[model samples]
Target: MRRLLLVSCSVAGLLALLPASGAVAVELPMRKAGLWEMKVLSGGSVPEMTMQQCTDATTDKDMSTAMAPMAKEICSKQDIQKTATGYVTDSVCGISGITVKSRAEITGDFNSAYTVKTSSQSEGGLAGAARDSNSTIEAKWVGACKADQKPGDIIMPGGMKMNVKDMEKMKALIPKK
Candidate 1:
């Protein structure tokens, strides 16, 4: 009975947050068009990561539009609000039986540099236990993309290069549990 009550409350909380969650994409300020280098500092579950991308306003918008469907499929709540200091985002995303609740604070001018700090809690899964983690992504604008690079091109570690538009194709390669 206690477990049922907790489950019921969780569902209710999620539903209440999305009274009008339709497919609306939140409007965000665009970063200056250029090459960007992003460093991710995450202490748990995975090691730190670094990547570079060539992006323009159109590329950013297209990436957001393309990811909407996947996000809606897994996330029940995703809210972004402008705060006095910066922007705050809260999301509840679940896959299989594991649910992850995360909150992120974003700051800095999108033109030159930006930072995103996130803290997340997970339960009802994660190897049959719960886990918590925090991460920060710091990004800075570089001069420009390489001559051979195009908009939406991302250079990952080990010199792996991929375009944002190709993400959907790679998604199919992931095994579903």
Candidate 2:
């Protein structure tokens, strides 16, 4: 009797573990457009210097030279998809010799058909200028799947390519207290 009981228990347990046949399957929601945003604050000012003056600065020249090469290397490392639309603005304030602030916004949809939008801004002091400079960049994306996708997944589409890694590096350039 004990042996018989053990066999019955084992069979019952195994049967219970099996899935029920003819069960209906549930489908997940389809991907959709989303919005994203990023903000960056750096050290510097652009108010005192015009576009030409800022471009002429040694620091600006160095940065321009460095970025040209860096862009190619970094862009390949960061594979991003989707269209991005944004702009850059610089302003100067106070007695600062040349303070500058720049902002860029991006928006696009991923392979999954999820939409993404983002904005980034940064401010800093121009090279060979007086006064301390401060800059800030803010980016925001909204839509479905945004909460699910990591920052790196959102690609800046079109010829204007960028990635979260680049943003992070740019953020690091900002001055901190």
Candidate 3:
């Protein structure tokens, strides 16, 4: 369960870190409207996960709201610099008792497919364990959504379907000390 949570949180963090469209300092290019699938390959405490999401104009505009409750505990500052081929992101996020500093570079056209390379470190938390992880996400247009899937619907690797906002409701079900 812990591993699953970690995987879910990591995915959330990645999504939250993605540059949103608007007057923000760094805005990622908008993707094509369609069903997009992301494949996560992690080599740290986080397990691999695959998630498919339906993206339309509305959902694309409201993407910043898709994250776990734990993400609220993180205070982040990001700077994006455009490169010749892509954009580079430097971000510092404080999570739990650790401050994660990461640098990521994104390349390729945002409409069909793109790649992100990230490296991060932590100074405190769980015996000050410093974990380094990198992931590659390949997203492509998969046509229209199915009858059961709607915009903002996310399907997890194990066939779990959820709306990212529902995470808070699920967390409320857990007993706290």
Candidate 4:
């Protein structure tokens, strides 16, 4: 009687705690097609570039070409985490075992927006084994068209330039068929 009730109450209390322990939720930001700014922050040989510089250096056509190769390599890495919503990849790029993790949103737009966040370690071994050496990089970008845009329209805080070719290239790399 009393002992049976005590046992049942303990079991119910344990079951109630199970949901709280196993619950997990992740939220991602929303992005739409339009003009956007980019910023690249990196360590090592890769130069830190602004959104304007990337937009200027890449034309819609050129961007399409470069991004194809870049995305293929990035998506195929072993450390990549793929989910129904998006993907994340972590890798070691240099001989020094510098780790770089890039996270890109899986979206419907041909030229999907992305933000890559990278972290690195200086010591020549696995990330955990390494001593006190860590570095980080963040890259952000957006893509879209303007009606007033001509064949070679450039928009920016400065006089930076971007072409349809670059936009096209970026669009092709987005995760849509």
Candidate 5:
């Protein structure tokens, strides 16, 4: 579950970097402020999972950079294209001794709902074993946040709660020197 959350968060952060359109370097269209549910169907070794997140514009923006700390160290060669219904992204990166090639397709009204389909292959890890996987993530606005939920909070399966913003803050606190 923790591994899944990490992958999902990283993917979410990557998706958030999409430009609003071909001519605009803006963020993706904003979704309604409230609870949003995401269902992830992952092929390969990863399990299927579902989770709910609390969000607003600010939180979404903050989460976009949540992976900044690792981005420079691991990611490179990102290519994105905007289409009528959504966008497609392809990237190459190195992580944990493996080189990964990834592609994702996103569609739907980003303001109210969106779905992302991602496929990736990792090479040079796991004792030289290559790994390939695909995941479909569907997210929908589920109205206002619950009383206990707050922006930046995501409730994982089994009721684990994570605040991506808080995690980013903690990452920031680590001194480079």
Candidate 6:
């Protein structure tokens, strides 16, 4: 159950990090090729987690492709606008039984470092309790991937490792439509 929660939390956060081209007017820049370390901090209920991902242009492009259709299917509204400081996004998405309405501010370019501050309200899930959450995710390019790591490889908390390209095999772990 802990691993499932970890995957759920990771996916939710990752959806916000990726560039949502299908719904947004402005195209967010892609991350530079390297290993990126991401820290997720949410106050209150959710726990803080950190993970690292190895990626290149092809991997990033594949992620965008995979996410575009899923977002279009599950998200009812997704709006993004650029500001002098960075980007702001508002989105409403329903995944499985939970409905999430969120707003986020993204700052800094993807080449070096980026931060995403997100506030969201979620309701109508198994817990049956409505909850409000505020989270900040900071990601930075640390350098090249380890010799053993390849593109799409992610090192999760507690040294759990997975590859994004292999997620399809774990579809059962993902929420259903």
- The candidate that wins on TM-score is 6
> Per-residue alpha-carbon lDDT of model 3 for 76-175, expressed as tens digits?
5566778898888776666456667777777887577776666666567677766655655556667777788888788888898886545556545534
How badly does each model clash, as a count of residue pairs? 0, 40, 0, 11, 0, 0
* lDDT assessment of candidate 4: 0.35
TM-scores of the candidates in the order shown: 0.79, 0.20, 0.75, 0.33, 0.80, 0.86
lDDT top scorer: 6
Report the lDDT tens digits of candidate 6 across residue range 1-177: 344344444455666655555543775778999999999887555678899999999998887766766776677877778889988887877877888888888899899999988878877778867767777889999999999999999998899999888754554454766
The whole-model lDDT of each prediction reads 0.69, 0.27, 0.63, 0.35, 0.70, 0.77
Cα TM-score of candidate 6: 0.86
Tens-place lDDT digits, model 2, residues 16-81:
111222233111121123333322333232221101011112332343334433333322221122
lDDT of 2: 0.27
Residue 107: error of model 2 in Å? 23
Off by over 4 Å in 5: 1-26, 169-177
N/CA/C clash count, model 6: 0
- Model 1: ten consecutive residues of lowest lDDT: 11-20
Stretches of candidate 6 off by over 4 Å are 1-10, 21-24, 168-177
* Predicted structure 1: lDDT: 0.69
Specify the poorest-scoring 10-residue window by lDDT in model 2. Answer: 47-56
As a whole number from 0 to 100, the lDDT of residue 46 in candidate 4 is 42
Task: Judge candidate 5 at residue 19 and give its lDDT.
Answer: 38
Cα RMSD of all models vs. native, in order, equals 8.2, 27.5, 4.4, 19.4, 3.9, 2.6
Model 4, TM vs. native: 0.33
Which ranges of candidate 1 are over 4 A from the true structure? 1-26, 44-46, 124-126, 170-177
